[model samples]
Target: MSEPRWLTDEEQHVWREFSVATRMLQAHLEGQLQHESNMPHTYYEVLVALSEAPEHRLRMSELADARKSSRSRLSHAVSRLEANGWVRRESCPTDKRGAWAVLTAEGFAAIKAAAPGHVEAVRESLFGPLTAEQVVALGEISTAIREGLSPRCAAAAAAAEAESACAGEVPEESFGVA
Candidate 1:
């Protein structure tokens, strides 16, 4: 095989900028959430996803995939939220072996309390710094990346589900890995 082509200087700079921006943006958002809402961004995402899920519930495996987290991590997180009266897990009635994570009314309230601050933080840290055209460009770029990645992600998710079902367990590495 031939050696991989190196990035050009401009490409390298752009890539570095994107990485830094993403890290900084996450840090900023996390800080905002912690300071204003007493919650972590990841936990908030789980609550939000559950709130939006059908019947305010989703399969544990599916929730892990949606959050790009491992089952263990999600389990731990859900436990924490359950302690806070924000979430609860129930066994799937249709499948005795399956479980579903459900957002409790308290969880819905917490997310509702957190949403305004989160949106304002996002706006302040991101859109406030961008021009309208730049915002549109960012959206286009994000859509392009998602469009390219979604099929691969979906295929991997399906494969994981099938494999787990066949084996009667999720792989140790079944956690979503970016």
Candidate 2:
């Protein structure tokens, strides 16, 4: 194999900062969601994804992909949410092998209640320290990184948009963070 290219000092610094920031941001968001909403960040993400979907539901695989979670992990989280009366699983009508994750009325209410606090927490954790221009830059930077890391996400998103359009529902353009 050819010798691996090493990061220059500036690249190293940037990478380290990005890594640490991601770790810290995740931890902070998890803590905030857990404390205020009685759910972890992952659960919040699942609910948010479902909420943004048509009829507050999505296919299990779609939800798993949207949340960037393993199927098993999503299943477990859905179970927990089900136990809390926040979400329920439904077998897909057309696809025998497929299932759907539906957000319950309680789930909608719960998310509605939790959203403000979650937004505030996110703002505090990420955007509060940044200038307006920096926040704009951050959004661009995040989108670029996300696209680079998961090229398939863009295609999936496009497919979702087409599906939504056909179904007479508008696709959510932004990450449903709450």
Candidate 3:
């Protein structure tokens, strides 16, 4: 293997700034969520993803992928959500071997109740500090990053799916049309 190329000085500075900004943003968001909603950032993300999903439910494996979380981590989170009466795990009728995590009525209620505060927090914590031009720049930057990363991400997801099938942990049919 060859030594990796070093970042240019400007690249290094931008990289460090990006890392710091990401950490600070996450900390601010998580702190606000905990204070106002009694929910962690991760839990809020899980709920957000589910709320946007079809029937407010997603296959457990798909949820894990969408959340960029591991199956075990999502399972534990869902278990906690279940205990809170916000979510429930059910076996998929279409696939006896598969399971789904469905957002409950209570979960929707909780999200509805929390949405205002969360949006306010988001605005105050980040966007409020930015000028309109800055917000546009941020959106452009995010789109670029997403466009650059998406193909590699999709390929990796496909590879992981193939590996899971080979390992007998997930059947290929799991990716079939819902």
**Can you write out model 3's per-residue Cα lDDT over 47-139, one digit (the tens) per residue?**
999999999999988898899775667777888888899988888787876888899999998888778888998899789989999999999
Q: Write the per-residue lDDT of candidate 1 for residues 40-133, one digit (tens) a residue.
A: 9999999999989998988888898889776778888888898899988787677766777889999999999999999999999999999999
Give lDDT for model 3: 0.84
Per-model TM-score, in order, reads 0.84, 0.81, 0.83
Model 3 per-residue lDDT at 43: 88
Q: Which runs in model 2 stand beyond 4 Å of their true positions? A: 152-178
Q: Is candidate 2 or candidate 3 better by lDDT?
A: 3
Using TM-score, rank the candidates from best to worst. Answer: 1, 3, 2
CA lDDT of each candidate? 0.86, 0.82, 0.84
Whole-model lDDT for model 1 versus the true structure? 0.86
User: Which TM-score value belongs to model 2?
Assistant: 0.81
Q: What is the TM-score (0 to 1) of candidate 3?
A: 0.83
Deviating ranges (above 4 Å) for candidate 3: 1-3, 160-178
| Global CA lDDT computed for model 2 | 0.82
lDDT per residue for candidate 2 within 1-178, as digits (tens), equals 9999999999999999999999999999999888988888888988999999999998877887788875566778888888899998887677666778899999999999989999998899899999999999999998998879786865775686578769985233211211
- Candidate 3's displacement at residue 138, Å, is 1.1
